[model samples]
Target: MQIREARADERDALLSVHRAAFGNTEGEAAGDTIATLAAELLDDPTAQPVLSLVAEADRELVGHVLFTPVTLADQAVQGGYILAPLAVLPGVQGRGIGSTLMRAGLEQLRSRGATYVMVLGDPNYYGRAGFATGHQIKTPHEIPYPEAWMAQELVSGALAGLAGTLRCANALNAPEHW
Candidate 1:
């Protein structure tokens, strides 16, 4: 398997993988849509310091991960990012594609001077990638899933004494039925 930045032509295939990987989960349909919009918006020229990576095997896309700008309520802390919609095709799960995508994406973000990275995901999965609960860092986002809402500091002391709501690019509204 190989990992690389996603090309324009691969969007649909990546979306297909996302749908398939997350389709059965609760609230995933709308999450998938939001993820797609986030990816598209991040590609806009005006967007700064965004990173999206994909993993492929035998010429078929297998996984995707995205990182975008985020901020703490305190203006002093800048260059934060959010990780969302990490997806690996069901058939490809447990093959390390997700981990590879995350490592590469986080490295790229750190190299670009990102201060911190936050993710809403399984603690066990993300914890393996160096993520810890926001409470550990005093994150302001009062995330409902305390355990699932996590953050990692790329730069030492990046999140020190910081607190604020963790808002997505667009104040994402959950679907009515959810």
Candidate 2:
């Protein structure tokens, strides 16, 4: 399988992958919401420079992930990013597609000068990819599952002394997303 930045025309395929992957776990309505958020995230002014990637094999899009700007309430802290809506087609869930996509995405973010990355996901799953319970990080958005809220430093000491509320991209600011 190949991992790369998704093409503009591949938006629908990305949505389909997320809808199928998330729908199985959270019902069709939640899937639909994520798909909608995918589109909205690209257009949201507060979410400039969005990173959207896809995994392909045999000419089919099988997995997808997105990383967008996350800011500290205090402007003094340089803006970081948050990973959300990561999805792999249901037919290929256990094939390491998600992990591969995540590693590649994080690498790209680091090259772009990003110091850290955050996510709201399963500790068992994301921990293997390097996310830890963000002890020094915080978010204003009331997360339903705090333990799932985690972060990772791309560069050593990236999270050192980091504090205050995290402001996610506009499309992800809604409480339902957490």
Candidate 3:
């Protein structure tokens, strides 16, 4: 398997991976919702400076992850990114594909001078990637499972003295996404 930045032409395949990953658990509607969010984030102006990565095995796309800009409301916080809609094909779920993709994405972000990356996901899963709960920074909306909202400092002391509500890209600002 190989990991790399997603090519523009692979948009449909990327969405298919997301659909299959989420569909297996929450039905087609849930899959479609996530797929649509991925699409919107790729196109949304507010989501500029985005990072999209894909994992391929046997020459087919098997996983995908997206990182979009986030900010402290009314303040300038450079290098703030949010990880969302990370998806790996259902057949490849347990093989570490998602984790590999995440590590790759974080490395790329770090190379680009990212200070931190936030993710709203399972504590057990994302914790393996170094994210932690109890961050001082708040999400744009109240999260149903606060423990699942996590962040990791890409650069040492990235979160130091940072405290405020986080503002995600417009495509991810909806309450349903929280």
Q: Which residue runs does candidate 3 get wrong by more than 4 Å?
A: none
lDDT of 2 by residue, 1-178 (tens): 9999999999899999989998988899978999888888977888878999999999999999999988788767664889988999889999899999999999999999998998988999999999999556777667778899899999899898888788887888887787
Error of 1 at 93 (Å): 0.2
The regions of model 1 sitting more than 4 angstroms off are: 26-48, 134-143, 171-178
My TM-score estimates for the predictions, one after another, are: 0.82, 0.96, 0.98
Which residue window of length 10 is worst by lDDT in model 3? 69-78
The weakest ten consecutive residues by lDDT in model 1 span: 169-178
Q: In candidate 1, what are the lDDT values of residues 81-164, reduced to their tens digit?
A: 888668888787998889999999999998898888988788999999999975444334345566877889898987777776
lDDT of 3 by residue, 16-98 (tens): 99999999989999999999999999999999989999999999999999999898977787889999989999988999999
Give me the runs in candidate 2 sitting further than 4 Å from their true place. Answer: none
| All candidates in order of TM-score, best leading | 3, 2, 1
lDDT of each: 0.73, 0.89, 0.94
Reference-based lDDT, residue 93, model 2? 94
Best-matching candidate per lDDT: 3
Per-candidate total of colliding backbone pairs = 1, 0, 0
Ranking of predictions according to lDDT: 3, 2, 1
Residue 88, candidate 1: alpha-carbon lDDT:
87
